[model samples]
Target: MTSDSMLREVHVRDAIGLVLAHDLTQILPGTFKGRLFKKGHIIREQDMERLLDIGKEHIYILSLEDGYIHEDEAAIRMAEALRGENLSLTETHEGKVSLISDIHGLVKVNREFVDAANAIEQVVVSTLLNNSVVQSKGAVVGTRVIPLVVKEQTVCQIEQLALQLKQQAEREAGPITVKPFLPMKVGLITTGSEVYNGRITDKFGPIVMDKITAFGSTVIEQRLAPDDRDQIVAEIQYFAELGVDMILLTGGMSVDPDDRTPGAIKQAGADIVSYGTPMLPGSMLLMAYLPVGDRRVPVLGLPGCVMHDPYTSFDVLLPRICAGETIERSDITAMGYGGLYRC
Candidate 1:
């Protein structure tokens, strides 16, 4: 809380030791960073030159509106409403609270809940795509109050909306959460006569290997099979017998005459989750599950988009799979809303 009697405007040079009345942003070449100085930050003599360089001839040393919530306090309340497990909050700056991932995993944001919260006046919660794979210490979301000073009631309303969302979600972790990946042993089968022969080197194997390793998984068995349905099926069966949790079949997912990976999975008695996706460059993707006795093995058929597209349908679903999510047709269809991945 700030009182009107404490308001003061002071020159930059004379502002040393005075607390900043608001947040100050510091931007460098090719980057715009925030929180250079928070509202409650006490000015230091060393910051004087930097402040002058940023074109601050004078600054408001202490000026807070009456009957309104300060930006920092408002941001704190807003962040508290959305914080979940594996998420940590950074210091508030310019009325913004950056949400960072505490571990490398998949991020889940409840869209309906977020929309309802944002509908409240003076409240904003911006986040990355839902189910995005975020690295440890990466920035995932940001929460803030739009105005420098908002009516106290605005904060209360935003908090109430968040509470409602949490209740509706019925999860102890709330509407926003990160599902950590489980350790997995993945088997990869690359199918393409061109690569199986000596014609062209296989490119998809290394890419898939890197992705698996980054998610704390290992490629226990990798095999190259010609574009023959029986050979692909045989390879998948072999891996499943080896007790691999997941199998990836790449390079024969497209509609070309040589593309037999989908047929091979069907021949292997795998239950097809979805034959294709609505995502651009990845619409030919396939997902399936093979039941081996009491165990179920997830099988993914990757299209050529995996080799080129920076982010595709495979990227969208891999994290969920790694997090032990059983992705259904409806889940894949929901991704179509933001599935267009442009190079």
Candidate 2:
């Protein structure tokens, strides 16, 4: 049949045994709204009454030519082009396929690839923001083509583009991937004379521990230290000696004379990435890497706000750190744009 005659709209009574060209949706005000007949479904005799009740007097039937592709097939091909490691694809439904995470990790997307894909006519690939944290089975991306029957060449262009991009990057994976978090052994040090001297109960350790555990890591040991710079430095060295993957020092990060966490981190032979950030509630945060025997361990000097704030710079960087990323000054500086949390 010619392209113009590829799709035929027939009355519901005559549609029996014919395949549906696309999904048919039914809506009952505030009661229900969903697909009544999926794409490619062979219309049945029993479906006539229900189809008529949903006001489906006529429905289109697809007789695709060699050069044309159905939406379901197009969606599957598009998802294959976009699927990366640690991601799973859902069955195509209503011309769309969703990308789901197979593990709890950070979702990374190539924004340039997404932009280029969307630039192709009738093609759609939508994704969550790059570097988003997702749990197992969370949906991260959706892929589909706009039309019920797209020209096969259109879909091929997307596949070729993905191939070219991957080849150029010298990687085997596609534009989207989930990097799993590493279970790091952490050492925590609470630095404040008020808590170290037993004048007040320590709260920072518990909060820090909770955050670490949530990311599938544990605090190997928790140490208390007075505000003295040497004492704080000594605790940092001790954790380095223990070969902890990460060290977290909470409190005393401010510029106050008695607050010396930042200086102590530097004194302990760490390469400070950033001693401060532009993010509120975490402006005094410190990020560093301390050299061990063969590897460098991440050391963070968290500001006082971390003990109380629901989300701070610590929360921003911890996941990346746990994912085996080296925190950089650029990363710390970039947090400023979306960093304002308090009113």
Candidate 3:
């Protein structure tokens, strides 16, 4: 369907000098299914045979009027207004502009700002959910004006509102940013006497390694320390001295009397970031940072949830950390809204 505007009918032979009102779709089973000629394309002699081959005897084109903005121009201008750091834009075409991620990283979107912009007349920008982990070159947002033609005044209002939203978001964070992942040299420590003594197979170790490896990092060194606070502290110290980027204290983080991993992190002289989270299946998560020379190494105390649960708070936070994000207590607290992992 065409955008909100009057259309002018033109015969295929008389289509030159007119703008296509809608996309001309071409469908061929198992081979092609896309636009033969995009909307807003100006007709030319070369397009006549192609248009006829696509079964177009006549076509509808936008009847341009003064004081009205064309869809292509509107989309480009709107994209400029909505563009933020770590975002790239493709050339506007067919009245659409795609916002792409410039790096493999976490996507941070200011939803409030996006909503405000969408509320403007004829302005439409769709994006991935906030805090989504995205790959580089992936399309994060698709923007276009709703109508084929809109009043120039409407366009001006959209740009102004977008500017206000951008400014307000800049005061806080921004409308969007791709936080790139860092190459982490992880020191893995498996806690629990059962796992360490080989009575129970070390399921957490392989799981932690898999998670770390997915983010382009590998376990530099791994230690199985029975839930002795002193022994855990010693393992942590050894990894620190080896200059690992982060430490993973897996298993034995529950309220059981045998769980001593949390205290051991404290004894190892790491600043605790948070001892718990609101997320289910992983609420017992613990996070800390230890100083090794001039650098601070993050030490994560994963709950028992990582052993069996396919997803949990650890999944949400680990990628951000790998992306060089310094997660805080408030970050964990704010996760309660979507913290139900079981569903």
Model 3 alpha-carbon miss at residue 207, Å: 1.2
lDDT on C-alpha atoms for all candidate structures: 0.84, 0.90, 0.84
Cand. 3 TM to true fold: 0.87
Residue 174 of model 2 has an lDDT of 91
Q: Give lDDT tens digits, candidate 2, residues 1-343.
A: 3445788889999988888987889999999999988998999999999999999998888888889988888989998999899998999877899999999999889998999999999898999988789999999999998878889998899899889989999999998999999999999999999999999999888899999999999999999999899999999999999889999999898888888898889999999999898898788888999999889999999888988889988888998999998888888888889789873
- Give the number of colliding residue pairs in candidate 2: 0
C-alpha root-mean-square deviation, each candidate? 5.2, 2.7, 3.2
Clashing pairs in 3: none
Off by over 4 Å in 3: 1-6, 26-34, 49-57, 90-95, 153-158, 161-174
Q: Give the number of the best model, judged by lDDT.
A: 2
Model 3: per-residue Cα lDDT over 176-290, one tens digit each: 6677778899999988888889898887788889999888888997899997999999999999989899899987788889889999999999999899988897899998889
1-343 per-residue lDDT for model 1 (tens digits): 4344555789988888887877787888787776677787788999988898777879887655566767778888877778888998898766689888999989988888788878887688898778888899998888887666667787787677768776776766656778799999999998999999969998888898988888899999789999999999999999989999999999888788878999999999999999999888689989999999998789999998888777788888888889999989899888778677763
lDDT of 1 at 276: 95
